[model samples]
Structures are given as C-alpha cells and as structure tokens.
Target: MAGDSLFGIHGAALEVRAQRMGVLASNIANASTPGFKARDIDFKQALASLEGGQGGGIAAATKYRIPVQTSMDGNTVELSEEQTAFAENAIQYQSTLSFLNGRIGQITRALKGE
Candidate 1:
C-alpha cells in the first residue's frame, strides 16, 4: 500500500483485474469438465484487503460461483456467462492499465521538468 500512493487505487485494481481474468479464463477452460465448479474473485473485497494491508489478498476473495442452471454432470461453468465476464474484466484491466500508463507519463514529464 505504500506504493499505492503513487498510482492511487489503479495499481491494486490492475492486480485484481488480472487475477480475475485468470479465474474467468480457468472457468472458461474447464467448462466441459464434469464436477468443475467455477470460481471468481470479488474485486472490491480483494482490493480492499490489499489496501487495508491484510494478508490473503485474492485467495480470500475468491468464491465459488452459483450456476444459473445446474448441469447433470455437476459442472457449474456457464460458457456464455464466463465469456461475458472475461470480456468485461478484460476491458476493465485495459482501463486500469491506461490509468497507470498516464500516471507514469505524468511522472516522467515532471521529472523531465516538462
């Protein structure tokens, strides 16, 4: 959190978004695997934990997703839902990255006395 002051919440946000992307990707990858239960990160909770200086980070915020429709094989992944979440997370990740990039640019310009 010490470094967070440099970029505000965007730094932690980027990390959470990246982790969420992986979780969503995993869900998408295991969509056909029987008994595979989809899991996702609670972005707010994860970010809060990080900013609050608490341990556990993403793992503590990770939660099993409840399926919109149960499958006979017990696989909880819904491909469409996972895909949509992934896309949205990807967009958010990009936005966070952009914010960080802009911040870095400002720092660079300031350092150069520009």
Candidate 2:
C-alpha cells in the first residue's frame, strides 16, 4: 500500500471514478429497457468508506438515481443525464491518472537524485 500513501486519495478516487463510469454506461445502455432503474455511486461516500478502512467495494455506495423527469415505462435511465455524468466522470478519471503519473515521475526523479 506504499502507492496508496504516495498517491493519496487520488488512487482510490480513480477507482471510484472508473466504477462510476461503468455504472453510468450501464444506465445509458439500458435506457430503452423498461423498468430499468439507473444506479449511480456516491463518490464522496465511497471514497470515505475506502479511506475509513471499510473493505466493502464501491457497491456499498451504489444507489438508484432519482430522475428529474420520470418516464412512463418506469425506466429511470435518462439518456442526456447519463451521457453527461459519464463524460464528467471520464474527465475526472483522466485528471486523477495524470496527477498520479506526475507524482510517480517526481518520485522517480527524486530517487535518481535529480
């Protein structure tokens, strides 16, 4: 877990974001399926649980999303909303990855006495 200390919460954050992306993608994929309720992860709660030494996976933070406008088929997966969330989560995942890469580069340089 040395990397955990080196990367801080960004590591866990990246995992949560990745999981969230999958959930959002599922929502988008199931948009047409009747009675398919969209589920999303609570990033803050997930990260906190991980940091708190809770062994539960991100599934612990997964919850059904409340649609702003419900569809007649009882499906809660809103295409526009799911797409937007997926895009935002992807951006955040990339940002976290970049930060971790930068940190690793810095550590490598320090070890090389550069």
Candidate 3:
C-alpha cells in the first residue's frame, strides 16, 4: 500500500526523462570535442518499454544512436536541438512535479477528512 503512493507510470516516466535530459546536456556540452558522436534520448522507446513491462531480455528503451552526418572533427551536437530538448524536458519535469504534488495533497485531504 505504501508503494501505491508513487504515481506508477508518471513517476517512472519522469525519472527516465530526467536521466535522458542529463545525457543530452552532456552531449551538447561536448559538441566541440573531436570524435564525439552525439548521444540522444529515446523517449518513445523508453515509454514503450515501460508499457510493455518487459525485463530480463533485450532492453527496447535504449538510446540507439544519433543520425549525425559525418564530421571530420566528429562532433555532432546541434546547439538549437539540444536547447529545444532541454526546454521540453524541463517542462515535462515541472508538469510531473505539479501532478505529484496535487496527488499528495488529495491524499492529505482525505486523511484529514477535509
């Protein structure tokens, strides 16, 4: 019952997104580095994996690769793209936090008979 406090899919989804955000940020930061094949976050695949509820096998929710063109220096991150991803991730995180807060408040009210 205690574990029920977690927002099931929402909580897990947000965590995965947050982790992805970190990876994307790192890639962007190292965009100027030589031979760096930019990393990406597989949000859709992650969500599918969560929904599929599969484990102990091939992980579908893996960030496969970046569709980067061949660069001599080998840096593939685009500033605009990374910024966009970061903005979107931030919004999603905030929205999830708001939702969890509301859920907790609802439970609190129920406990108080309010």
lDDT of 3: 0.70
Q: After superposition, how far is residue 19 of candidate 1 from its true place, in Å?
A: 0.4
- The lDDT ranking, best first, is 1, 2, 3
Give residue 22's lDDT in candidate 2 (0 to 100).
Answer: 93
**Candidate 3 deviant stretches above 4 angstroms:** 1-6, 56-60, 64-70
Which scores better on lDDT, 1 or 3? Answer: 1
Which stretches of candidate 2 lie above 4 Å from their native place? none
Candidate 1 C-alpha lDDT tens digits along 1-114 = 767669988889999999999999999999999999999999999999998889999999999999989799999999999999999999999998998999999999999999
Cα shift from native, residue 15, model 3 (Å):
1.0
Whole-structure CA lDDT of model 1: 0.94
Cα lDDT tens digits, model 2, 12-52, are 89989999999999999999999999999999989998877
TM-score for all models, in order of appearance: 0.97, 0.92, 0.79
**lDDT of model 2 at position 72:** 99
Clashing pairs in 3: none
Reference-based TM-score, model 3: 0.79
Q: How many residue pairs clash in each candidate?
A: 0, 0, 0
Against the reference, the lDDT scores of all candidates come to 0.94, 0.91, 0.70
